[model samples]
Target chain A: MLAIFKREMRAYFTSPVGYMFCAIFYAVSGFLFMLNTVQAGESANYASYFSILLFLFIVIIPLLTMKLVSEERKMKTDQLIMTAPVTLFDIVMGKYLAALTMFGSAFLSSSILYYIPLAIYGKPNAGLYIGCVIGVFLVGSAFISIGIFISSLTENQFISAFGTIGAIIFLLFVSALNSFINNEAIRNFLNGLSITTRYTYFSNGILRYDSLLYFISLSAVFLFFTVRVFERRRWSKS
Target chain B: MIKVEHLTKQYGDRYAVNDISFEVKKGEIVGFLGPNGAGKSTTMNILTGYLSSTSGKAMVDGLDILEHPLAVKKKVGFLPETPPLYLEMTVKEYLNFIYDLKKCTLNRKEHILEVCKVVKIEDTMNRMIKNLSKGYRQRVGIAGAIIGNPEVIIFDEPTNGLDPKQIIDIRNLIRELGKERTIILSTHILSEVKAVCDRILIINEGKIVADELTENIEGALRGNRRLAIRIEGPSSSVLSSIKKIAGVIYADISVEHEDGSATFIVESKNNVDLRKPIFYMLAKNSWPILSLEFTGANLEDIFISVVDEADAEATVGKK
Candidate 1:
């Protein structure tokens, strides 16, 4: 697992995809940070910061994960990895962790904006900032797992990327689609399904275990699907 | 040692690898000979734990592949039809990654360097795989497969795209590697099997049609006896006189040239040596014999006959 992780991490940097992901992430986040806090002349509230962060996650999660398994399949390198002494869980987790690490690095870099506000205004609530960071990381991890699952389903990286983006966009707006529902039961169900609702608890400094579990479970479900995709391919004749 | 039992792989309604079974003993180099889509790659994939069989099981050493894939995979090295390589990585990086993935605890630097020396890719270790030529990339792929020093090595079309010189070099390397590891090579190149394999398994249409020692298989394909004779005489006289010999099956004039000389290829009855009879008859007829050479069946002939027979049977079955 460590070997696959190291190799995948290096491949990210060696190819232009890794640098492009980092640059786009930083560029968009930096612009959002400046526009939301500096230009607006409002006190730095992590609420706006996190709202923009969610937008960044929706776009960039696919970019970071689109090629994880899809590229391996396209290049036929999955044969080497799948045939090796490693298990399917190791492969899925290794790739997921590598992409998460890359995403985390970019996310952490953008956290520099939090400090800029700290210098200008009185110190914001430290606990809330930490919770928001954790929230973004967990949400991003869930998205990355989704990307991994999508990547495993096809050999075309473009399809994987766009598929993941479409799914995430749908999830992001699922709550809005439920607005017209007059039935309380349907509204509650749709609200629970919204990732933004789960993330809302973190942005407000409330660390709810239920929300955490939702993200973790979501990630697990997708990873399990990824493993099944590989297992079926390995067993079934092409 | 590897044992495959009644293994089958079916794609929807078609059997890519129909009910097939074979065994490879310790320290033996076995060749899987078949034309394209003859289940050579599929069989290798199943053996290496890259794919699971639709029915039956594959056992490596003593453990079943489906039940204990990691254990089987740990002891086996597989090079698929296309060398699975990450083009962005240099040879050294790719190999190091494979070593780690294979969970090798050996001296990493020493082992990798030795493999590089063996495959003759030492100088290209620092170069990215994308920049290397096809042959060098192939060597890198081989180097990766053998990195863990596994007991069994499976190579699928290892020499597909190499030049003649590189083919010879890789063949020699395979021969050397076969000394210690149980190697399974799958290819349509018959001469390669004759050159490197101890036993040959000829598969066609997902069936194991022939499995025997290379020499024994070749001999069986050649049948009990056959001979070719070169004669300096009129073609009709040579044919009639040779046919008159007791043990000879009719003689067919194979070649006729401007000089009016003919070469006849003769198929004789079992346990018959018609050479002396032919010589005496030719001398009596005043048709001097120029040269004679006995021809034996080779791997190519055996492969063709087996596949052709299978195809004919399939056609007959369809009707």
Candidate 2:
């Protein structure tokens, strides 16, 4: 597992994809930060940053996760990883961790925007700031898992990226559809299923166990599915 | 040592490999000869635990591949047909990654150097794989496969893309590797099988058509009655005279030269050696014998005949 993780992480920096992902992420988030807070003359608050952060994730998550497993299959390097003295869990986890690490790098760099306001205005809500960071991390982790699972289904990077973006978009906007529903039970169930709703608790500095469990379990379930995809392929090829 | 029994792999309604069985004893270099899509790679993949057999078993060094994949994988080094490599990485980095993946306890730096030395890729160790030539990339792939000094090495088309010189170099390396490890090489190149393999297993359409020692495979194709004779005589007369012999099934002037001397390839009945009778006939006819040699069937002929017979049987079955 460690070996695969190390190789995958190195692969990111060696190719242009990793740098392109970070640059695009940083550029878009920086532009959003300047336009929303600086140019509009609004106070830099957790609420404003969280809103833009969610948008950032909707686009950036697919880029980070696009080539995770799909490129391995494309290059036929999956044969090496699959035939190694490692389990399918190890290969999936190693790739997931590598994608998460790349996302973390970009996520951490974007956090520099939080400090710009702290240096200028009165002290912002430290608790809210911390909450937003953790919230975005969890959201990104879950999105990365989804991307990994999608990537496992195909060898084309474009297809994997589009599939991930489509899925994330559906999950992100699922909360908005609740207004049209008259039945309270179905609305509540749909609201619970929404990623936006789950992230709302973290954005507001409320550490709800249900929300955390939801995100953690969401990531775990997708990762488990990814492993099963690989295992099933191994069995079918046999 | 590797033992496979009744191995079968089916895809949907089709059997990619159907009820095949073979064994490779320790220190044996076995050649798997088959045409494209003959299930050679599929069988090697199954034995290396890259794929699972639908039925039957593959045991490597006494461990069942399905039941204990890691244990079996640890003992086997596999170079798939495409030489699975991460092009973004340098040769050294790729090998080091493989060493770690194989969980080798040997001195990492020293072991890597030794492998590069063996595969003759030491000069390209620091170069990115994407920039290296196909032959060099293949060497790196082989290097990674052999990093842990696995007890068994399975190479699928190891010499597919190399030039003649590199092919010979790789063949020699495979022979050297066979001294300490059981090697199974799959290729359509019959000469390679004759050069490097101790035993040859000819597969046609997912079944083992012929399995025998390399020398015996050549001998089995000879069947004791085919001879190549060089004579200083008229082609028509010599052929006509040879065909009159009781044991001669047929005699044809295979090679005709501008000088009137010709070579005749003669086929005799089963269990008959026609050399003495041919010599006596030539002498009685006042013809001078330049040379007489037995030209037995090589691996190429045996492979073609075996595949042809299989195709004939399939045609008969379909009819």
CA shift of B98, model 1, Å: 0.8
* TM, every model: 0.94, 0.93
List residue ranges in candidate 1 displaced over 4 A.
Answer: B233-241, B244-246, B256-260, B270-273, B276-288, B295-298, B315-319
lDDT of 1 by residue, B7-76 (tens): 9999999999999988999999999999999999999999998888899889999999999989999999
For model 2, the stretches where C-alpha displacement exceeds 4 angstroms are A34-43, A109-120, A181-186, B222-224, B233-262, B269-273, B280-286, B317-319
**Each candidate's lDDT (Cα)?**
0.89, 0.88
Cand. 1 Cα-lDDT: 0.89
**What would the per-residue lDDT of candidate 2 be over residues B1-319, giving only the tens digit for each residue?**
8999999988887788888999999999999999999989999989888888889999998899999999999999999999898888889999999999989999999999999999999998889999998989899989989999999999999999799999999999999999999999999999999999999998888889889999788766555467888899878988899999889887888888777789999988657879888899999998888888877566677789889998899899989
- Chain A of candidate 1 gets a TM-score of 0.94
Q: Highest DockQ among the candidates is held by which one?
A: 1
Worst 10 residues of 1 chain B by lDDT: B217-226
Q: What DockQ does each prediction reach against the true complex?
A: 0.82, 0.66
